[model samples]
Target: MAEKVVMAMSGGVDSSVGAYLLKKQGYDVIGVTMQIWQDEKRCDIEDKGGCCGLSAVEDARKVCADLDIPFYVFNFKQIFKDKVINYFIDEYYLGRTPNPCIACNKHVKWEALLARALFMEAQYIATGHYAKITELKNGRYALQMDFNNPKDQTYALYGLTQFQLKHTLMPLSGIEKDEVRSIAKEIGLKVFNKPDSQEICFISDNNYGGFIEEEGGKKILPGNFVNTDGDIIGKHKGIVHYTVGQRKGLGIAFGKPMFVKEINPLTNEVVLSENKELFSEGLMASDINYMAVESVKEPMEAYAKIRYSHKPVLSEITAQGENILCKFKESQRAVTPGQAAVFYDKDGNILCGGVIERAV
Candidate 1:
């Protein structure tokens, strides 16, 4: 019998092509779409940039039928709300920004669905993430950048464990986005020209503040917008509506441009300051997960990326007590709390990553 592999299909060209490629490679492919978020009354099937909906489920089923593969839609809505959505709202309420995609990839797809694949006797579980996993000389697995794909998703996969890396497969690693769509077209997949999802999967309209308020069951009260020196300058709509490095919509006619320097949930104060205050020389991160190696025993030089789209900057990292401290060679702008700071080697290998607790 052929080895069985489970593919996480998102009803997009990337995943559809991924399934086609894996099936062609002689594996028994099973397509699974996660029903992560669905509120039939409120969610519109025609939403511009959502990943999960009635339409996406239908599209995945159609692709699976065309490929003659078995398809399944597992309901993960409650788990998503408990793990990813709750964390997102809690982070914002605690005066920090959170990346829900990272949490979803970690807790939902890799953990929950990987276990499901194991139950089905599947040898490996795969996704269309633009990343690669290669074996190191030490017989360990390393997550590396996908050079052929411009949109690198290694940042989101940083939470994956070593065991998960060994069992996971990313078929889209060596292929470019445009070429993936081309392959889907060539294979006669109906979603060959589907647009990529841009917004968060759960937030249909992209109103993050509104979603937080509605789901979290708490109203964000207006807070005082103060300067760094504790001088009240203006009133903010709410703490959840602002983030670090935000420069607009302050509703304050300050003489010059002012940015959100910090958010104080304790005193309900949003600190506004000049643009220069947003830059930080370093950051402190906790919940570190290392890859390509077991742990960081000494201070090592590496390139660090503060945000998903930011370019990697040179930095030196040292293992502190229960946390890691990253000192950049130069000041990095808007090193926000609760966002990930992923470290990488010169060869584009993911060293490790952690949550930003504070700016140094």
Candidate 2:
């Protein structure tokens, strides 16, 4: 009998093609769409953004029907709200910029969705994530860079646990985005030409501050924008409205362009500084997850990415108790706290990753 595999279909070209590929591979493939949130305003259907909305569900259903696979819609709204959304808000409230995609992968897609797949007796769970899983000699799984587009490779998948990695598969790992689109078109999937959803799915307009206000019921107050010398240059709408390295939409005019340096929530202050001040030499990361090996014993040289779109920089990493400190060979800019710092080996294998704690 063929092994049963559950594919997490998100109604995107990558996922639609993922299902098609898995089905063709002779796996007992079943398509599962996670209903993570509801469209309260009903405006997102027209917006063509936000994933996990009603339209995404409809699209996933259509693809499953076309693939002749059993479709299942798992309502993970409560889990998503508690794990991903709440964590995002809490991190921002604490003067840190959280990557919701990393949290969603760690908490929702891998933990919650994988558990649902296991409950359905699936031997493996698959997704459209642009990551590769490789089995090592010691019966462990390691995440490798996707063969498609190195720039689009998802190193954030380093957070995936050994068990999750062992049972998970990424069909889009070997194929480029254009090839995935072509396959989806060949399969006549409805979302073949659909644009990728870039923003947080729960946030309709990408107004994170507005979402926080609506959910938390706390009105963020106006704050003073100060320079490095502690001189108040102007007033900001709120501290939450600003982030490190933000230059546009400051609503403040200075002699020269100024960027947001830091947000002091306790004092309700947004610090502005020159673009050069944003660069940092190193950062500390906590809550590290190691999939390739047990732990980093000696200081190892590797490439590290401070953000999702950031190019991996040469760095030397050391494990300090529960935290890992990464010192880059050169200064990096906007190394935000709560964002993940994923490490990779010389050959592009993901070493490990963790959340940025502080920049030194």
Regions of candidate 1 where Cα sits further than 4 Å from its true position:
40-45
TM-score of each: 0.97, 0.96
lDDT of 1: 0.88
Tell me how far the alpha carbon of residue 303 in candidate 2 is from the true structure, in angstroms, after superposition.
Answer: 0.5
Local lDDT at 209 for model 2: 79
> Cα lDDT of model 2 overall?
0.83
Error (Å) of candidate 1 at residue 32 is 0.4
Q: After superposition, how far is residue 241 of candidate 2 from its true place, in Å?
A: 0.6
Give candidate 2 regions above 4 Å deviation.
40-46, 147-151
True lDDT of residue 239, candidate 1: 93
For each candidate, what is the lDDT? 0.88, 0.83
lDDT of 2 at 38: 76
Encode model 1's per-residue lDDT on 1-360: one tens digit a residue. Answer: 988999998888888888998999999999999998676434444555356787888888999999999999999888888999999999999999999999999999999999999999999999988898988887878789764456889988888999999999889886788888888988798798878887677776777788888888888999899999999889988899888998977777988999998999999999988888889999999999888777889998888999888888999999998788999999999999999999888778888999999999
Query: With candidate 2 superimposed using the best TM-score fit, by how many Å does residue 142's alpha carbon deviate from the native?
Result: 1.7
Across 39-138, the per-residue lDDT of candidate 2 in tens digits comes to: 7463274355446877888888998999999998989989888988889888878778888888888888889988988998898999987877888776
Top candidate, metric TM-score: 1
